[model samples]
Target: MKNEVQVKGKFHYRLIGWKYSIWVRLLLFLLLALIFYMSLYVKLVPQVYDIQLGAVSEKTIYAPRQIENAVATEQAKEDAAKRVQPVYRVVNLKNDALIDAIYDKLLQINVDEEVKFDDKVSIYRRVIPQLISELENQSVKTLRNSGQYNDSLLEQIQQGLAEQQYQLPEEAFFKLPRLTKEDLTAMLPVTKDIVSKLMNDQILDAQTARAKVAELVNTSNLTKNTSRELVTEIVRAVITPNKFFDQKGTDDARGQARESVKPVYINKNDVLVNVGDVITEEIYARLDNLELLKDKANHLPQLGLAILAALLSFVVFMFVRQSTLPITYNNSQLVMLILIFLINVAGMKIISLGQNMDYPYIGYLAPMALGSILITILLDAPLAFISSVLFSLMASIIFNTEHMLLFDFRYGLVSLVICFVAVFTIQRASQRATILKAGLMISFFSMLTITAMMLMEDQFSQKEAIMSLSFAAAGGLLTVVFVIGLLPFFEVAFGILSPLKLVELSNPNHPLLRKLLTETPGTYHHSVMVGNLSEAAAESIGADGLLCRVGSYYHDIGKTKRPSYFIENQTNIENPHDRIDPNLSKSIIVAHPRDGVEMLKDFKMPKPIRDIAEQHHGTTLLHFFYHKAVKQAEEEGADNGIREEDFRYPGPKAQSKEAAIVGIADSVEAAVRSLRNPTLEQIDSMVHKIIKSRLDDGQFNECDLTLKELDTIAKTLNETLLGIFHSRIEYPSELASKKTGT
Candidate 1:
């Protein structure tokens, strides 16, 4: 027997070998990063302007980036700090001691009964002056030691104390001696209480304290005029300004006020100096601070953009590496992904160039969904989802006019909505027109997203809103155009069998499918049954059911060459293999898979369909032919050189879950169809038995199908076959029924 058929295309063969090479993948990722960097280079670098202070008659200048206006922020903070009032601390001044001393002196003078009354009155008057002087001295010392008052404050304190001192009238002094020792004691507490109360309150001056002293004395327990007057005078002399400026506390409060102020920012695209307006020193400084001034070169923006590009590339690379899809690991598929990425980024860059115009919403015109639509059609939906996110991020950056701003939420949001809409709408696309439908869906969703974004703004413009909606709708149509136009190139270049291509191949009018139906109708019917079983089983395990169905349709295209040789097409005809040697029959049986592969390649079918055709038999033995050869050798008592290996189909076993499922379905369909009246139990047993045989033969080793998925496939096939060959209920004979009725 010949070796396994090699049906790989020239381009596929060249790149397929490098799929697993780490160096090749790294280079491909580098290329992706390079595309990102180049596309964003213009937006990343700040635009430089030539202007000087006092210059006039120039075009309007908009801020190229969002930057903190340090000068303005500092000025605002200073203003906030100045708005805070000065903090003051209150001192207690020890008024209780001063009042006690004055009372003790007066009591001492009154107790001198040996002296003349007039002379004692003179002594009381003299002691009153001494006590008042002592009170003033003590207040000055206390105020100085409080650490809150300066020398100027201390002088003010002295002046306030001097003005508050009671002037002792000659009659009042004589009356002071008339008070008894008990009266003096009562008055002492009244004086101390009034002074302490007044000092505890914030006293900025002695005049304020003196005004309240008379009222405080009258309200006290002392009813005698002499005692009240003495208490009032004493209280006034002791009270001085205790509240002083707290420099440290005031500074701290101001500092907090400054800290609480938020920094002022110059928003992106904010007008710096409009046309015909002079560029003052302030305006020139602002431009310099934003790094938009000429002769100021900043490479940080470029370096940052490069880092972002590398990050996006890494995310994509990691996602592809971790994906279980067979095509994800193919170098050709990676190249296709790179090309799609470049095209999308380039479109965004081109659209961003319009930002230089007066229209800021021109970014809405970018066909952001183009890449996602193409990816969903050519690759898996999950991969397309991830690519959509990355594309939105790139669009945000590319469309951003602000050099310092990494992303614009408006662009990112709209791009994300359209990309997701495209992916979901086109995920199950079956026809070429489905791409247009996806575009329309994307367009509708884009308009909704744009409208919602515009409504969120503080200002709304009817004209701008209409323009943005128009751009969004046009963007969707453009996406459809690009997807439809570019799909054929990707399909032919990489030999990827996308869903749309599969749909076209599944058509009955295709040259190969038509030949199978016309030349080998029986085989074609068998293929259709296999397709039904394979599709159901594949769908049960989350595999590509469409690929399985379409692959099954053409899996036996080679049987068209010699339809009578196959049992399915041998309707009412003699078995041709009965006359031929079993070995020759084995060759013919095994040759069909190879012949099918060659026929598929000549027809220029995608690699996956051809792979299904080539691997569906998976080196399975020609059981009937092998056994016949064995029996013939046993009867002749001679060695016929019959090896089980030679009787087997030459196969590179199923390389994917879809191929493995198709193989299992192909076997189970033929077996169940051969049964005359397969009961539900027999059909179920047959499905499990064929699967178990394939498992034991190691046919599923190359694919990722687990034993669990195989069980699921078995269960699905059983149900499908029962539905296909359901039995009807039996009825009694008409003659017996009529006799019983008579």
Candidate 2:
């Protein structure tokens, strides 16, 4: 038998093919660049202003963008340095030694017996001046050479004494009674006690030490006031400041203080100068850093942004090229992907314009989840996940607050989490209602993410937290609304056969399906069985079982156009082909697939369903009609020139796994339905036969089905068919007769 198949014209296919060529690729790249560059231009390039410090501006100059407040940062450093306390070292050891020597000399002079009272007075007066000089010299020497003596304190005390013109009377020194050993010993204890206490304490100045010495002398039980006065003078002369300033340590502490202070930031869009406000030096500097006070040309930031956008676009392109979905390779899909990303970015930008408002967290209201949900529905989850990440990155920057460094991770983090949640929960959405369900998931996740971010900020407030959570939840719902509104548009404009759309088309209430069911019930039942078989077979091979099942349900839609011409729809009626010409019968049989395709197109069904209806028969031969025509031609002894090619249906073959599996299932179901109570063995044999015939005919050549997968499909179809057409056991004859009699 000749295998005749009609070809669908290749004009659109050729056009699509040409779009993937080198020049077309470059044009697509250019288009992407233009879009990205435009999106980023205002953001990256700092808005320039030529106003100088103290200049009256023609218009109000707002801060172009955020930058470091150099002046404020420096002031913070200075304040930190000033807050560092000066360092000091203990230097009290030398003070004790100097006091001891002075005491010994006084004791020696007092104990002497060789001199008269008058001579003793002169000697005491001379010795007293010399001892005071010695004490002063020793203290000053220690202050200069060691860390123990505070020179400033010592000098301060000496200057006070010189200004007072303090002169110990000769009578006070000479009038001291000749002391016994006990007296000298008592004096020694007194001297040692006072000096030790004063030296151990942190004395930065000499006035305190002198005051302590005077208090001690006044409290002492002295025989004479003059003696007490001479002792007080000696004690005051010896006392000095022990705590000395440590310049190196103090400087190091100041350095550390400077290092500890964080650099202050000047927020983006911070008012540089209000309307009619004079420009200050600080405002000028801020504008200069933002490149608003422009004298120098700056293009690096713009170029860098361009490169970043290009890299991001390239990564998205590569991901789509290597993704698991076959539809991603279509140029329309690529265009849609880019357009979706740009639209999401545009939304972010529009919302970001108000980031400077009092409600800083208003950026949380952006519907970033829209992109993830749409991508998940239109494409696959992996692409949706990737798009979610990219959209989050864009959100972080676009929705960034001036207080944030670089990008605001709060927005990015929340967007990423919520978007991923949307993608994960709705990856297999099969109904328009599922989008609403996914929206609820997104809302819950967004609120949760917002709460987490607020808690992390360590600045969570009840009112602000509630506001943020509400906004996030609202944003999620808005995303759902946007997705629901845009989904049908994308489906129609791009001819995307989304799972939701497929589910819609698969409804029995659909016009085409209703027609098939009413006018061609036999074909309808056959299509239903085919759907079951194809679904099972598809699942076995990791194909889209839903698509296969749905495609199978509508695969024989064309049979409804000429319901009586097909055997399945003819039911118990006489065969129409008996009186009709064989060529006419062949023509009717061949016309159905095309007729179904046209009907589907007229109804504006998605392309995948139409394709399945058009390609389910593929190029398989109409063996019965061809053979009957040959036999008649031979019986009549005519030319017998009946061509086998004329008996085949017009076919583009099965172009996808779903379509191919549906085709195989359609044939198997029709073959099995013709049997009278088929046994499991007969069902298995028929299933294998149908699959082998199609495989041998190269019907699966266009799709990606492997040999192993084909075997799996055959085994799966066998099991499904056996279950549907299982043999019933006959009851025993005696049991059947007894039941009937009873």
Candidate 3:
């Protein structure tokens, strides 16, 4: 009874596996059309970052040519020298205004001098007179410039100047509004009042003049020099030659050799060289040469860029075709490509806009790694390979101007090796460890490729090659680190079924399958064999083998609810079908798939595994029960008759790759297992025949599996099934009985 129920499970799975819905194919076709349309509109052309002649760029170098021809007047020069000096204005306690300015104003310099409130006001009062004089001149000039003779404008200007007395001390740094004539005139009347106010307040005592003034005036003019030593610094700025290296006072090393100084003569055949310096005269000559680029001065390689773009685009087209991964409808795939290209553009701009950016080794951090990792993970090997080649070309354009091909090949080769290494290493395992291992492999390969590219150039020294190799190593490490970090984001965002998750479900210890194993061991044993068969078949088709195995494990979990109804869960039981009505028997059996899907959902299985649990049987008729119902009606002379469709399992068919693959493997496994004393020839015939039946029944309607892949899957299943259920030469019934009875 257990064997019969297991056989039934297999039959249902196989029935769904061989279908290919026309709708799925049509959807894929539409997706390709959209992708093709986008890819075509994107023109693949190389850009030469041509620098225009005499374009306004921020020039930092001090040119000797810009020096003034007219010599400065001695008096004016001397005056500027005195004025521009960094003179720290120490607050003289004798001047009240100066002391007030020091305490109230945000000083230009830090000072530690103590100033009495009386002296602060006096000091600022000294500076105010000149400020007011300059303020009135500016206001009158503005009125004259207005070209209006109105007295109101003149009076208003005078009134505005009247308000300037207190604010006169504020400089341009204070952002005070410009003064008018009225402000100045008004201040004139109050100027004496301000002085009187400070005198009454005892804020004026003395005035400490500037050093220039102190030097010019006699000491007798001052009442007393009681000012503290405030370290009033004055900077006499002179554009003198950098005289720090001028050692005229020191004895010359060439002193004695001056009279008998002989120029060092070099013999053409024997030249003495210094240590740590290259002695190549030819190389030294090259250092002094600088190319003066002129716009439209030389022919631009416009056509050359076009040709390169064509070749690259062709390679890209080939790679996209070979992968057989339909990503045109996938928004994630489109977004990834867009992001990668934008990074490439930004990197190119960085390299081109550079004035003294030391590149050829300082690969832009983003494009070098993020692009490669994304291509390898999102796209497959072929697409990654093509992108790597294109990126190599872009790298050369990004890093090189005169020698564009050199850097392009160097980066391109490194990227290809890293991407290739990435795809292969990660194709089997979705674990973090695999990503790290892939990184290590990428590092080695990238280093090797960089080394080869460097040597081929015949230009770089050993040290330079080592630097390039360092860049390659960094790129490899970055690829691994970034992709590994980004994996969880992709998984949750896209509901991705990575290989690692599939592996976890494929484990024999999974709880739902374990319950089946202990409670209904027959079902468990059958599932295990089915898992093995499906895995091999799925692998042959390049559909996830782990997914096939894992899906098969939970496919029959509904059998647990009605253990006795299922043949595999029954133990030495009388046939329940004999006593029960045929309709009841059919209901109990057919409910397993729907019940299993619900149980799988409750256990929180991934959608693909859940899909297999439900979609394994598709909508195929339960022929035995349907025929039994017809027979019962005929025997009992019942007027009512039943449709065969009523006995079918309600289904959407195998709607995805893994679901379809599992369905085929499930059916083939049960059919082959149910045969008692089955020969190798019978197993071979049964598996093929089961697949053919499914294909004819249109069970595999909603998946992307092609006929070629299906054939491959079938062949793989046959091989694995043969190995597991391999026949042995029967010694005899007597030998078999003797061994068993002992």
Q: Pick the candidate with the highest TM-score.
A: 2
lDDT score for candidate 3 against the true structure:
0.54
lDDT of 3 by residue, 1-742 (tens): 2222211222222222112233543443344334333332212222112223333322211111111212233344444434442211111112234333332232321131365433444544454444443545454565556654244444434443343223332232122112223332333223323333333331111122122323422222222221111111100000001111112212232333242333322211122222334424432332112222233333334444445545554555455445445443344454445455445445434433331223346552323544555555555555665666566556545544333233444555565566667667766565558777877777778778777776787788776677667766765676667676666565555556667667667666888878888787877887888888888888776677787787888888888888877666667888788888889988988898899989988876777788888988887777878888899999999975698778887876887777777777777877776777666567777877887888888887656677788888878877887688766423356466878995
Deviating ranges (above 4 Å) for candidate 2? 1-18, 30-45, 52-298, 327-329, 726-742
**Each model's Cα RMSD:** 28.2, 28.0, 22.4
| 562: Cα error in model 1, Å | 0.7
* Model 1, span 1-742: residue lDDT tens: 1432222221122232576556887899999999988887766766677887788937888776565668899999999999999886666666777777877877887788887888877787787778778866877897688776767656655665566566656677777778788998788777777877887788776687789989988888898887888777667667777776666678889999999988776656667878999888888888888777776677788888889889989999889878876455567688888999988888877776666434677888898999998889888899999999999888887787654476788899999988998899999999998998888888899999988887888477788888889989898898888888899999998877888988888999999888998889999999999999999999999998999999999888888878889999998999899999999988888788889999998988888999999999998888999999999999999976778998898997887888889899989989988887566667878999999999999898777798899999999998888777766211235445766995
List model 2 lDDT by residue over 1-742, tens digit each. Answer: 1332222421123243533455656567567767777766665656677686787766766665455667899999999999899887664336566556756765676677766667667776776567656665665665667654345645644554344323565556655545445566666666667767776777767667778887887777765655567667666666665565666668888999999887665555566677776788876766666657657668788888888778877877788667655444356676777678777777777766665434578788888888888888887788888888888877777776553355778888989998998888888788888888888887888888887776777888787888788878788788888888888889888878788888887889988888888888888888889989999999998898998888888888888878898888776789889999888998898898898888888987778888888988888899999999999999999997888778887788887888889998988888877776565667778878988898898888777788899889989987786677655412255456877995
Clashes of each: 0, 4, 39
As for model 1, its CA RMSD to the true structure in angstroms is 28.2
Listed in order, each prediction's TM-score against the native is 0.63, 0.65, 0.52
Whole-model lDDT values for every prediction? 0.82, 0.75, 0.54
* Stretches > 4 Å off in candidate 1: 1-17, 49-293, 326-329, 356-359, 402-406, 728-742
